[model samples]
Structures are given as structure tokens and as C-alpha cells.
Target: MDLVKFFHMNGGVGDASYLNNSGLQRMGIMKTRRIIEEAISNLCKSNIIKYPKTLVMADLGCSLGPNTLLVGSMVIDEVAKTSQEMGLNPPEVQINLNDLPTNDFNTIFCALHEREKKLNTEKITDVHYSPPSCYFTGVPGSYFGRLFPAESLNFVHSSYSLHWLSQLPKLREINKGNVYLASTTPESVSKAYYEQFQADFLQFLRCRSEEMMVGGRMVLTFAGRTTEDPRGEESYYYLWRPLAMALQEMVSEGLVDEVKLDSFNLPWFTASPTEIMKLVEIEGSFTIDHIEIFDVNWEAWKTKKYDNDNDNDASTDDNGVGHAVAKSVRAGIETLVANHLVKQ
Candidate 1:
């Protein structure tokens, strides 16, 4: 299947939509808020913004949801505050929210005005109440390739995005009845995944390098494991294991074909920090200024606090955590399954 044409989260603001099922993803944005602020804050403090009248930034893999504006708005807010502190004219922010062509970009487009209003510029005593003019353009395409003109971007931010490879790895030995790297997956399959990640990640860095100005700041947070063991990568287990088990149960009940399960594999990999560092060293476009890892509870999105904190309409009872997770997984990969696994 052509992933660019077919791959997308369940669209519309329904119960099963990615718009509603993305609390865990929202937590990611909140968790990494500081890194994003610090990057743009430092950028504004430097001579970079002093020269340019425009600030170009992008949110790669920005699927449709309330969380879509969370980071983008924060960048605008930080730039406005920093410009106010320095008594400089704020630059107009040009935001490119990039994703596949099939993503629900309209859902994001409809909310840009309100996001612009709440820029948090209390410190700016200009009395005119002027903040940076933010222009959001939905770039409907994959981030695995270049989406911007050369040296045009000033800053870039991506969270919970890079783990998705451009395509599935070429497996010499398919791990039947599985969708991702697992304990029973053959070493060759795991190696295939690793090599694919290395290749795709290098392309990603190369594209960003050519598109961004020299010393342009970027904050990237993705699903990365600390363990070197591919078979034991924690995020994959939590993210894919449950869905794989459910598929296997269907296979046992003869509802799903064994051959279909044998051929299907998810196009995702959770690289470790070391693996990422090695790629950056090879890519040689950006420096490893700061690198760290933090753990979130596997069921963090199941908390009642998440419902109250985020605009997500997804609610989970104590026992509904499992069901919520199932729905969440479906929101992400139902296209892949319907196209590749269930096609008859």
C-alpha cells in the first residue's frame, strides 16, 4: 500500500477519532514544553531573530487534534515574550504543520484563530497588545523528505513523531502473527528494522539540515527506549504488544487469516538515545546539545487527570483502560491493518 496516500489517523471529532484518542500524545507535548521554550528562547536571544523579520517553524507529523496547536502556540508565545523582553519588534511566525496528505488538516486549520488570540503576552506592556503575527499553512506531505525551501526555517519542533519510518523494513524472516519487533521476532527482522531506522533518520536529518538556517534551533522528542536490546524495547511492547495479541486471538478464532498475520509488520521503530546519537554523529548536520530520557507510565493516558487536562473527549472507566488503548491503537494503525492485513 502507498502509505502516503492511505496512512492517516481516524478522522473527524468522533469517539474513535485521533482528535479524541490523543491524550497520551498530548502529555508528550506538555512534558516536552520546556525543551521547546528553551530552544526558541535561546534562538530569540541570539542574533538570528535580530536579522530576520520572519520566523519559520514546523510541526512534523502533526496529526489533527487539540494538541496540534499546543506546541505551535507555545513557540509563538515564547517568541513574543522574548521580543518584548528585548524591546525588539516581534517577527511574523510562519508555521508549517506537515503530515501525510491524508491527515485531517482542516481540523487544525479551523482552530488557528483562537490559538493566535491566546498568545500569553501579559508581560508585553505595548498597550497595543500586539504579538507576533502567526500564519499557519498545512503542508500536506510526508516529513521523510524535504518540505521546505533551503535555509528558510529558523526553528523546528517535532514530538512523538520520528519513530515512524518511511516504510516497513525488508524482513528476511517474517515474524508470523506479529506486527512489530518482539521477543519471538527473529534477529534478522530486528536488524532489518534497525538498518531501516538508520537510513530513514539520516534522510530526515539531511533534509532538515538543508532547509534550516545555520544555528537554527530544533527540539525533537520521540519514542526512544534506553535498552540496547531490540527484542526488549519497552515502548514497542506497550504500543504494539496488546494489539498483536488481539490479532493473534482473532487468528486463533479463524476470523483472521494466518497468512495475513504472517505478512504484516508495522513501519515503526523506537530507537535508543545512543542509536540516535550515532546517527547524528554520522549525519553531522546538528550537534547533540542535550540528550536525556524519561519514562511515562504505560497507562498514563488512562488517568482521570488526562481527561480534565486535555480537550480530549475520550473518557475511560477503570476497566475501560484496555478498551481505550485498543481504540487508541486503532486510531493510529487501522488504515494499515485494513489495507494490508484484512484486504481479501
Candidate 2:
């Protein structure tokens, strides 16, 4: 299987959409912004840490642009409000936005331009607003070594990213004969998903541990699964298996080459809150300030009732067949087949 090409197509598509969609961007930004605010609020209340006017914060997998600006603006505003109440000066915020080199830089630059216009109009004379610095970079491989100076950041954030590993597992390692087939069951897929999540997450925390100030905080949010099924029947399988079948059907219809289908697999994985918490426990660098799980409307699959409360009804035709079919297949391929194809 040509893993690089497959990722370039599938993974690239997902990241592009994430950065371009305003609705999706808003949802992610608002959630992370709230967490940052709350964490700062708690720190202030305890008097454990004082709000520095010039705080350094970063969005590790900061896709496009507005989301990064959203975070930066929120941090500036929060510090301003806190300082006013505490009789301290508002701190200047240094926002570092990081993402893969393949991400859309043009769109990000445009978004930053718009944010700059807004900030200029506000003209809050009491404080200085510095243009946020942006870096095009990847994590895991990029972060394991040192990217930032020691004890340089006050907070770090990532969203809907990091579940993606530096590289997908080798196909030969799972099923030597045919790389295209489902080499592992759904349950096995779920377990492997969590295992990778823990490893990558720990690596991330450990790297951040060195960069973050002693009392620095981090908040991350991403897609996750809830079922304990080995085959991942109730949760992601419903979306994936159909896609695999669809690809098989496509091959039979001569719509695409069997070789391409064989090489393709999901590019990302989802984790349950329990699985995520366990990784945090093991890492032991940062305490759980708060963790919340809520339903994410992915515009695919019918919602269903299950033990994990994550099931979706397959009967609903809310989005038409074409979109429904494509979305369902993509979700399955990205989250299920590709991520857990091999055992960790």
C-alpha cells in the first residue's frame, strides 16, 4: 500500500475542510477558549499563579487561521478583565499558531488579516496588541525533540488534531497476504486506538512539560468513540464497514482501481473519555482541570441508542444518499479501518 499517497488524499481532505468550515471552526474555537478561560480563572482564584500580561500560548495543531485568532483574542480579553478586577496591568499575549506544512497558508494569512482589522478598530489604548506569530510545523515527530525553549509557555491547546499519528501502521505487519482487507476486528481496532492515543498523548505532554511553566495548563478536544466492542460494531464500525463494502462495490463497478482501495485506510482514530483520562493519569504532568464529552454532529450516520449512548440510527436519510454515503464511508475509513488496522 502506498501510505503516503493515501494520507495525502484522505488526510489532506479532512484537514482542509476543518480549516475552511466556519461552523466547525467556531465549535472548536469556542470549546477550547472556554477551557483556557476556566483554567486561568481557577489559577487566579487559588493565587497559585498570577496572570502575566504577556502570556505565551499556543494551538499545537492550529489548522487554518480564525481559530488561532479566536484563542488569542480570548486570552487577551480574559487577561484584561482579570487585571482590571485585580488592579493589575493587562498583559500582552504572544500567540503561537502551529500546524502541518501542508495546511492552507493563504487562508490562514487572510484570516489573520481580518482579525488584525478588527483589533485595529477596537483601539483599546490601555494595552498593546501584538500580531500573533505563526509557524508551519507537525507534531509527534516534530515535538519529540525540542521545538520551543524551556519554560517559555503559559498554556497550550490542540483540537481535533493529534489523534493522527506521524505515520500509519505497516500493512504487512497486520495481514501479509492482502493489504486491503480488514486485518483486525473492530474490538481490536478500538483497543489499538487507545494504545496509540496514550503513547502519542504522553509524548505530547512530556514535550510540553519541558516547555510549559511549572503551573501551565493545556486543553485538547478531538473526535472519539465510546463503545467497548472489539469489532467496534456499535460505534465506528457502522460507518467504516459500509465504506469498505462500498469500496469493494466500486472496485467491482470499475469506478476505482483495486490497488488504490487496497492501499487506502482511515488516517485517524477516536478515543473514549475513559481511555483519554487513563493516558493523562499515566503521564501525570498536568492534573485534570475539567473534561467534558458531548455529541458531535458529523453530518453523517443516523443517531442510535447504545450502551455507550453513541449509536446512530442507520435509517434516517437527513442528508441525501450521496452525501450520507460519502460521509459515512469517510468517517469509517478515517476512524476505524485505517487507525486500528494493526495491533500496537
Candidate 3:
């Protein structure tokens, strides 16, 4: 599908939706946030780093709205609670919410504004509240370069985002027969996925190592798979392939030209726990504070519960599925496929 059309069909559904309460509940974002907060609290208790005032945080791939605010609030609340328990003053905090330039900045800005208004009206004077700032940038490209200065950040957190690389792999490098717009074979695609992830992830860690202060903590949560299928029949792929095939069928019916479908590839990848652990080992700077797999309660479209819903209701559920699929698809597209699947 033409990039623009594909985006029009699927836009505002990926990371953007994940930043909202509905999508967060479906993807266990609140649970992940709690885990991250606890980790930050533990780090504070150990005195591995100073409390409150010195803490600076960044949320990589923070989409557009409420989740960004929630992340900022969670960090601040955790720091304040920890500081009070320790009889120390709460820290000065700066949260940088980062994402691709194409993300909904207006929504993020609005969310931040709302958060600030709430804090001001409540006269929340306990901790110094700094407005969350946002940066339009992608993880693989400019994240380490201009977004943050050297040795400035105290904590780094990314949820359902890091699996994507800055870009896709090179077409010339892959085997001939194994290549397809969407490869279903595990071996053919897994090697490419692993290679790109290993490289981009190592770069991510190295960049963070430079950006973070000594003893800083980093927490990342992402979608993972039990199987090694490059194009396996998982719920994620099931959600997207229909859309992709729909677009392709549109091409066949002459609703759109072949060029349109040719330009698009499904974006998604899933990493096993072992694969992630190996990548961490190669990256070296980050210590694995905790790794927990939580269930993502996806309400599939073809399920009986969805059959009776109206288009609006179906679309809402579709948007949730879209969010989950985007994370997985973006990972595969960016990390494994040679073709540029994700628009940006």
C-alpha cells in the first residue's frame, strides 16, 4: 500500500494508542509502570544513587498522550515516596518523552499541560514538579546524538518500543528464495532479526552509557514471542496480515496499483526472553535489574465477543489490536526486513 494510505488506514493506532488508558490496559502498561517504579525505588533505597533532587528520567518511544504523563507521574510519585521514607527532600526531576517526529506532539503537549494544571490546582507542594518535556526523535538515529547531553540522565525507561531498529536491513544481504514481502520462515528471518537487534541494541546501550550518570537505572518493556517464527501465525500477525492482504487485494482489484502494495511491508517482530538476554549481554553497560513476562490480554477481532459489535466498537478494538501489532510489526520491519515497512 502507498505509505500515506497505509498510514491513513492505520495511523494514530500504534504507539499513539498505547499511550492512552484503553490501550495501556490491554497491553499491561500500568503493570509495567508499577514494575519500573518499584525498580527505581529499590535503586533509591540502596543509595546507589542520590534520591529525588538528582533524578533525571527519559522515556524512549513515548507515544503521544496519557501514558507519557502517567510515566512522569509514576517516577515523581515513586521518588517522593522513597524520599519521604528516607527523610530526605524530593529530587528535582526532568522527564524527556522521546519518539519519532511523526508522533502526535499536540496530544503529548496537551497531556503535559493537563498534568501541570492538575498539580498547580491541587497545590501539590510536596515535591518539585517539573513539566515533562518532549523530543521528536527516533531511537536508532538521533537519540544519543542531540536529544540528551553527556552524563546528564539519571534513568531511562522504554516500554513496547525498543524492539524496532532505526531502519531495516539491506536487501542484498539476504538469501534469494527466503525473501518475500513478508517471510513466514523462521530461520530466514530470525537471523536477520537477531543481527539488526544485536547491533542497534548495542548502540542503544552504548549511547545510554554515555548519556546516563554513573549508577543510573534503565528499564525496558517489550512484546516477546515464545516461537522463533519470522512470519509465524501469531495474534499480532493475524491482526495485521488481514489489513496488509486487504491492501494487496485492493491492488489486485485495481483499486490501487502494484506500486502501492510493493512499497509497504508489515512492521513487527517478537523477541524471546533468551534473545533479549543475549542482546543485553552483548550490550554490556545495562544490568538486568528485572525481567518479567506479563500476559497481554488482547481481545482478538474474530473472537465471538467482537462479532456482535458495531463498526465504532469494532474500530476501538481494532485500534487496540493495531497498537499491539504495530509494536511487533515495527520490530520485524525495522530489524529484519530489508524493505522499509514502517513509514518513518
Candidate 4:
């Protein structure tokens, strides 16, 4: 399937929409907020441009949601706060919220004006309000390639986005009977995934390197494993394993074709920090200023009980896992499923 045509967060404010089921992604943004703040502060303090009159920043893969603006607000707030502390004037913040062309950018634009008003009131002071301001724009494209002009960006951020490959690697014959990496997945399949990640990530860094000014900072936090192996326990088992099982059950019940399941593979890959560092070395564009890891439970966003609360709770199963996982995954990839697997 062509991900560019179909890979989008379930659009609108419907029940299955990304805005409704994106609590896990929101948690990830919150976890990495401090790092983003520190990066912005570093940009402000760095001698590269000495805090230029206009500050340019981009949030890559900023899909439509309330959390989409959360970090944008933080970046603006940090710039204001850091400038005040340093006794320097705040620069006009030009923020570009980027995602795939298929993303729900209209929803984000609709909510943006009100969000700007609220953030300005809360984060900025009246002295520089008339001149030094914050502007928000949407840039729609894949981050795996160049998306901005050369030397235009001062900071870049991407959270929970890099794991998605530009497209599934061309190894369908080797990775059979699974939509993602499984414990039984062949070594050839794993190698294909790793090679794709290396290529994608290297391209990502090269593009950012061209776009960002010297001494610029990019704070990225994505789904990655600590181990060298891509199929390690923390990487896939926590989520995709059970999701694949659910699909397998559907196949057994005759709702889905077994052959289709055998042919379909998700365009997602988790890389180790070592792998990422090696690629950064090869690309040699951005230096690794700092790195950290944090874990969120699979069921971190699930409510204890649903309103129905009957024998079968769609919020959670007997083991208290799949319901939330299913909703979250569906929010992200349901479009692909509808376009390719199901007969629409």
C-alpha cells in the first residue's frame, strides 16, 4: 500500500479520531517537554546567531490533536522565559507544524487562533507584544526528505514519529504472516527493517542539517529499543504482538483473508540508540548533545472502567491490555487498513 496516499491519523473529531485516542502520544510529548525546553534555551543562548530577530522552528510529524500545540506553546514560552532571564529581548517565533500531506491540518488551523490568543495571554508580556510575536504555520510533507529552505530552522522536534518508515521495506517474501516484527520473524526480515531505518534516519538527519543553522538543536524522542536487536522485548511485544494476534483471530473467524495477513507488513521500525548514534556518525550533521530513555506502561492511558461496564469491556480485556492498544493503533493506521485490506 502507498502510505503517502492512505497513512493518516483517523480524521475529524469522530470517536475513532486521532484527537480522541491520542493520550499515549500526548504522554510522550509531556515526557519529552523538558528536553524541548532545554533545547530552546540552548538555541537562545548559543552564540551562532546571537538570538536573531526571527526564530524559526519546526515540529515534524505534528499530527492534528490538542497535543499538537502543546509543545509549540512550550517552545514559545521557553523562548520568552529564557530571554527574560538573560535580559535579552524575545524574538518573533515562527513555528511550522509539519506532518504528512494526508494529515488533518484543517482541524489544527481551526483550533490555532484561539490557542494563540490563550498562549499569548499566559506566556508573553505586554511590552513586546506588538512587535515580537509568535506565528504558527503548517508544512505538509514527509520528514524523511527535505521540507524546508536551507539554513532556515533554529530548532526541530519530532516525538513518536520516527518509528514509522517512509514506506514498508521490500521484503514481503521473507516477513510472512505478520503486520510487524514478531518473535518468530526471520532474521532476513529483521535485517530488512534495520536497513530501512538506517536509510530513513540518515536522510532525516541530512535534511535537517541542511535546513537548520549552525549550532542548531533537534530534540527527537521516538519509539526505540535499548537492545541492538529490533525485535527485542520492549520494542514490539508491548504493543504490536497482541495487535497482530487480534488480526490473526479475525483471520481464523473468516472475517479477514489469511493470505492478505501474510502479505501485509506495517511500515514501522524501532531502532536502538547505538544504531541511531552510528547513523548520526555517518551523516555527521548534528551532534548528540544529550540522550535519555523513559518508559510508559502499555495501559498508561486506559481508564479503569467504561460507562457500559458490562461483561465485555471495550476499555480493557481480562488481562487489561488490548482495548486501549487497539484504539490507539486504530487511530494511527485505520486509514491504511481501510484502503488496502478491507473492501471499502
lDDT winner: 1
Q: Clash totals for all models, in order?
A: 0, 16, 12, 0
User: What lDDT tens digits, residue by residue, belong to model 4 across residues 132-247?
Assistant: 48788999899988999999998898888999999888784556656788777888888888888889999999899999998788989878888876766667776777767788
- Identify the superior model by TM-score, candidate 1 or candidate 3: 1
lDDT of 2 by residue, 114-167 (tens): 766786698656655333233232332244335588999877877767666645
Runs in model 2 deviating more than 4 A are 1-17, 43-53, 122-145, 171-194, 234-245, 298-344
Compute each candidate's TM-score over C-alphas. 0.92, 0.71, 0.72, 0.89
Best by TM-score: 1
Model 2 CA lDDT for position 53: 40
- For model 2 the TM-score comes to 0.71
Error of 1 at 70 (Å): 0.7
Those runs of model 1 whose alpha carbons end farther than 4 Å from true positions after fitting are: 48-51, 113-129, 304-310, 315-319
**Candidate 3 Cα deviation (angstroms), residue 89:** 1.4
Q: Which stretches of candidate 4 lie over 4 Å from their true place?
A: 117-132, 303-321
lDDT per residue as tens, model 1, 1-344: 57888999888888888888777778777777888888888887787435468889988998988878888879988888888878788889988998999998888877775554655533665684457888889998888899999999988888888998888888889796578988888999999999999999999999999999987998898888888987884756676888888889998898888888888898888998989999999999899888878765436668746424646447354556777777778888889999986747
lDDT of 4: 0.79
As a TM-score, model 1 comes out at: 0.92
lDDT of 1 at 8: 91
lDDT of each: 0.83, 0.55, 0.56, 0.79
* Candidate 4 or 2, higher TM-score: 4
